[model samples]
Target: MRSYLTRLLIVIQFVIIIFGLLQNENRAFLKQLFLRSDAVLFNGSLYRLYLHQQKPRDSMLVASHAVDDYSWLGAEPFLVIAHGLGPKLYGGDNTIKTLVKGRERGFRVYEVDISLTADNVLVCYHGGDETEINAMRYADYLAVCRSKGQDPCRFDDIVSYARKNPAVSFVLDVKNRFYDAYGMIRNAVGDQNLGKSFIPQVYDFEQLPFIRKDGLFAGEIFTSYRSALTNRQIFDYSKKYDVKVITLTLQRFVEQKGDFPRDLVILTHPVNDPFIAADVKKLGARGIYTSYITHRSIPELFTSALFFTPLKQV
Candidate 1:
């Protein structure tokens, strides 16, 4: 009878453990579903998905590295303006106009390409021929520009622009997917010997080491994911690379529920509510990314202030 009772107790414990595991798995799956749904909702329409699908794909390791260094150096908060469909949709003049206005308004600007390709050429436009951009080299793209009037501006041109405007920094968002293309961009950017006069901001975190090696721009990387595993993987990568600044979508930050490791700068879209912004700051976020600064303009509403006020003596 004693042996039988002991065996039964063991079986009950095992079942309880299994049930807990199943519950955890279910919660994780639900969280993932929610994240995907939220991403679609945030875009506001299925048309946005199609628009994103049509963009170029290229690895942006160099840009990622640049962002990392910039954050490490403690730069001011800035805005990232995305230009879609290349220079044809929004010409260089329009693009420059927007960037100039952002600067005049006391904001820094970073431009990202929408296309992804193997050559990993990150230029000033948003979307391009994904198939053609990925299949051909940057040089080939230049040739097409000369022949077909497709390419808008060169990376070097942006560098020169940054040199001319000392107060502004260029954020290059590489939309590429291939990893090797990152190295190609680094090579094109040349050795880090370029003085601080021409450093541009890069937004990819994976390219931190390359940019550090290249010695051109000083910026930090921004990465986002919909799943916990991917987020953890990125966090691990950041640790290994010693990255200091990280960017996440507002949804991801909320879903994590204050579980994110602290002490690093967290950048996210601006929130208008003073309470919510205070909550987010309480959760350890360091900066807010916004289309306009007005969203977070409340004075004396920081997280630290709310939590650390001295108590009156009784």
Candidate 2:
């Protein structure tokens, strides 16, 4: 019986060793796969993706075009100021003034309209029914706002306001289900120049356009908690479309770690804590979208001017 017990113990040890080896091999395989993917190649590098292929003069032309046409040149890091709700719900004027101030300080401001009224007007609000808004025209919404003692301005008026103010760039957050809203915005901003100035972000996947790289609205693909696609899938989609920026949650950023494409711009919630911000910077985030930029007058927090200082060298 003692001899049998010893044999059983030996078998158990052998099984444990096999399991350990398998685990190690699995981890190594995953590491190799990640390396093969080349997802993290552009981290901490200052290389342009399309620069090598294009000519020196042509590259400058493209850079200038992106800056002038695509809203790239104004600042190192872009500041996307989302005005939540209307003037009645939140202080709308205060939000606008703060954004204007940010733009004056050379930060590009993208204001999102989130209200879902039937008229589908873009006056700057958060999370409303897209279907309802598109059903109602912007003209009707203006009348409704005036009746309610609110400022009445058409979506075109907002674009005009941005045009008058050279520093400010508008990110029109279309929170409606109307298929033609994208084309409507393009037509409204007659000049291709003005159309290019606007970045239209869509929350619904069905609403997303197949070819959005050209024209007025750059798509800001919103990934919520209930999103079906994984971080890698989102990154791949963005790369395929040459999408310059993507906005997602802080939790998703942590989970994905180095999986995100280096060329894509990431906009996440502001990390208030300096340590957290430092870590986020190391992870290679382009910008942090927050109301903190409005509340905090200090420019450094909003701007990407500060370099990440290493606590310990890699």
Candidate 3:
């Protein structure tokens, strides 16, 4: 009877474990367990995307090295982590909690993906290529995302947080279009004279004059160029506008033998290679964006025995 009872208890516990895994309320918590790269999304019950890290690193090994992860780059050549504390580093992306944690870890500048809802409310989300999202109301979007185990960051919340934490700065990456972008932006700005604290990224050059008309959004505008021809045009037009930053996709940045365009703050994304990081440094990059900025050091950006080798921070 004792043996049978013990066996039954073990089976019961096993069943309970499996049941919990299936009905898990903490999907975000579960993501930290199997995440290979930065973040993996589980849409309620259907989707399971394993975002295999571009170069897989052991989470435990990375976590163990955090304290001594010799930070090489200070303010200049400023490091901006796209979408807040990289999903891999913080177990999620762009959440108010994750961003606050990043600031605690000494990260100052953050790039957040922004979109305007059907109700004219600006919300924070990286809904690129998700065409259906264009039609959803703010509440509807939030509900669907939440029901799908996603936490949507509110633009108002992020703005307020920035106001409270003056030391921290934000780079708003416009993910989708808005009807009255100026009003939405000004409303987000609220009372914070976020002079240098805020930088608005624009894709269309025509939007610049309108955005600048407010005067409150008087910070340097960040724009990108597709072709070399477009690059030259933007450069020429920049002489008339206050476009002070140029962002290039990491793929394009890597294609260049030398560095990005000089004189402006050139920031590239998802750059994980030390060789590339070093080359960009030599090319006079204003900054490099990496998901592992907190988990690893930029090569040659830190003091190490192998002068050029960046020591991993995990």
Best by lDDT: 3
Residue 57 accuracy (lDDT) in model 2: 30
lDDT of 3 by residue, 1-314 (tens): 99999778756754554455676595443432322111222221121222221211123111111221112223444464544544435545667767776665556667776777767777767665535546657888678667756567788888778778876667777666643655687766855356445666666555565555544543544455322223344455454454666666654444443434455566676565656565565555667665555423443453222224332222
Number of clashes in every candidate structure?
31, 9, 2
Superposed model 2: Cα runs more than 4 Å off? 1-90, 93-106, 114-116, 119-122, 127-153, 202-214, 218-226, 270-279, 294-296, 299-314
Model 3 / residue 42 / CA error / Å: 44
Q: Any runs in candidate 3 off by more than 4 Å, and if so which?
A: 1-75, 88-91, 147-150, 225-229, 259-261, 273-275, 294-314
Task: List TM-scores for all candidates, in order.
Answer: 0.53, 0.58, 0.64
- Candidate 1's TM-score reads 0.53
Q: By descending TM-score, how would the candidates be arranged? A: 3, 2, 1
Task: Candidate 1: list runs displaced more than 4 Å.
Answer: 1-31, 34-68, 71-94, 109-111, 114-122, 128-153, 177-184, 187-212, 226-228, 270-279, 294-314
Question: If both were scored by lDDT, which would come out higher, candidate 1 or candidate 2?
Answer: 2
Candidate 2 lDDT, 1-314, residue by residue in tens: 99999778756754554465468666554433332233343321211232222111312211112444444424565443533311223334324544544454344555556343454444443423545555666566666655655455456666677678655566665555445556566666777655656666644343344225354453344543334344665576555544557766676676666466767777665344544555566677665554434324444554546666543311
TM-score of model 2 (CA atoms)? 0.58
Ranking by lDDT: 3, 2, 1
